[model samples]
Target: MASRRTTRRLAADAGLLVVAAAFVLPLAWVILSALDPHANLRVKTPDGLTLDNFDAILTPEITFTPLLNSLILCGGATLLTVVCAALAAYPLSRFRSRFNRPFLLTILFATSLPITAIMVPVYALFVQVDLIDTMQGTIFFFAASQLPFAIWLMKNFMDGVPKELEEAAWTDGASAFQSLLRIVLPLMGPGVSVVTVFSFVMMWGNFFVPFMLLLTPDQMPASVSINDFFGNRGMVAYGQLAAFSIVYSTPVILLYVLIARRLGGGFALGGAVKG
Candidate 1:
């Protein structure tokens, strides 16, 4: 029995190492290739490190404008999604109704539907409305695409807060909105962070949505503009591509760092709920 257990443990550890390597190797290639001026598809050490790759792609046309567009699009969408999700979730969390379960189930169903399945109709609608190349239009769609899952997550987190606290606030003449803003939301900081980060990251990395909606080159976000690295006939600038990728990833990293504390902090509701 002891021998069998040892063998199983060893096998599990080996499998995990293999899985880790699969992810780590690609990331390693990206980092190393970014430093190599003449990078290729193969992962190997360069003759010497150089910053030429970074220098080449740091121009306003290649990096600055698209990055600014991404920040505007993803940032606006994330803020909108979080606010809408909070408002939509509050009633579902605090009220009792037979419709809530069905509504939530519908939201869950919506989340499972792939973006590609509806893109055809969405594109046609955008064209009809003359919003095909607009930034605000893209932000609206981005928020809508992420809203379903955001509501689901927000509702689950909001449920964790005790109703007694809201009742006390009600007795003090606070409105539903006030109670939500001052009490429930403060207690559910981790959930908001999760939703904000999830929404922003999803929008930031999304290539297809913005690609289909925005036609103007000047309006394209970093997600769509990164395709410029690939040239005709399967040619690609691997070094510059890797450098752009690292720069493109900076905002999301910074967002996570900013919210790290709130995301890790669980609801401190024990004392408030005890009495």
Candidate 2:
């Protein structure tokens, strides 16, 4: 029995290491390749490390413009998704109704549907409405695509907050919206952070949505513009591409850092409600 347990533990540890390497190796390649002046698809040490890769792609046309567009597009969509999710989730969390379950189930169903499945109709609708290449149009689509899962996450998190605090606020002449803004939302900080980060990251990494919606080169976000790294002759600037990838990932990493405290801090409702 002791020998069997040891074997199982060793097997589990080996399996985990393999999985970890699968993810870590690609990241290693990206960082290594970014520094290698003559970077290629193979992962290997370069003769000399240089910043030429970074310098080449730092121009306004390549890096700054698309990054700015991504910030605008993803940032706007994330804000909209969080606000709408909060509003939609509050009622489902606080109220008792038969319809809530069905509605939530519908949202869950919506989340499972692939974006590709509906892109044809969505593209046609955008063309019909003369919003095919507009920033606002893309922002709206980004918000809608993320809203379903955002609401599900928000509602689950909101459920953890106690209702007694809201009742106390109500006695003090606070409206439903006021109680939500001042009491419930403040208490569910972690939930809001999760939803915000999830929505922004999803929209930021998305290549297909913005690609299909926005046609104008000037309006393309970093997610879409990154495709330019691949030349017409199947030649890719691997070094520059790796550099851009690292820069592309910085905002999401910074967002997580900013909200790290809130995400780890569980609801401190210990003394708020007394029997």
Candidate 3:
């Protein structure tokens, strides 16, 4: 019995180690390949490293514009999504309406709809409105697409806030908007952060929407423009592409680090009552 238990424990540990290595090895390879000046596909320890890979891909036209466009599109969409989701959620969470159940079910259904299913009509509508290739136009769709799920998520977070907090705010002559803004939102910092991160990451990595919507290469986001590095003539610059991948990924990493600190704990409302 003792021998069997020990064997099982060793097997579990070995399985976990294999899984960890599987994920880490690819990332390690990418980092090493990006630093390799020779543009080799296989990651190898460098005898003498060079910054040529970084220098090659650091040009403004290829990398900078796309990155900036990604920031603008993703950042704008996240702001709108978080704000609208919060406002929409407050009523849904607070009110007892017969329509609420069906409405939420509809939103859940919407979340499962693939972009391909809507792409034809969506592009046609964008064309009709003269919104094709426009940043604002692309962002509007981004914000709108993420809202259904964002509202669902925000409602869950908002439900955790006590109505007593809003009641106290109301007794002090506060309006519904004031109660939501001052009392409810602060406590929901984690949820807002989660939504922000979710929306940003989605837009940042999205390739299909921007590709179908935007015509000009200059206005394209990083997700769409990364394809440029892979030449159409069967010439792919591996080192520069790897370096560009690292650079393109920086903003999301920074955002996660900055906002992730607030997600750890819920607000302590233990001493709300006054003697």
What is the TM-score of each predicted model, taking all chains together? 0.88, 0.88, 0.89
lDDT of each: 0.88, 0.88, 0.82
Off by over 4 Å in 3: 1-6, 232-234, 254-275
In model 1, which runs have C-alpha deviations exceeding 4 angstroms?
1-8, 232-235, 253-275
Model 1 clash pairs are: none
Query: What's the count of clashing pairs in each model shown?
Result: 0, 0, 0
Model 1 global lDDT (CA atoms, 0 to 1): 0.88
Candidate 2 local Cα displacement, residue 148, angstroms: 0.8
For 1-275, candidate 3 gives per-residue lDDT tens digits of: 99999999999999999999888877776688787767577757854677888887778888888898998998998899999999999989887999899998998788767866797788999999999889899999999998887887788878989899898888999999998998899988876777777678878988888999999989999998999877552678887788888999887777666655555432211111110
User: Could you tell me how far off, in angstroms, the CA of residue 68 lies in candidate 3 after the best superposition?
Assistant: 0.6
Q: Write the per-residue lDDT of candidate 1 for residues 134-196, one digit (tens) a residue.
A: 999999999999999889888888999999999999999999999999999999887788778
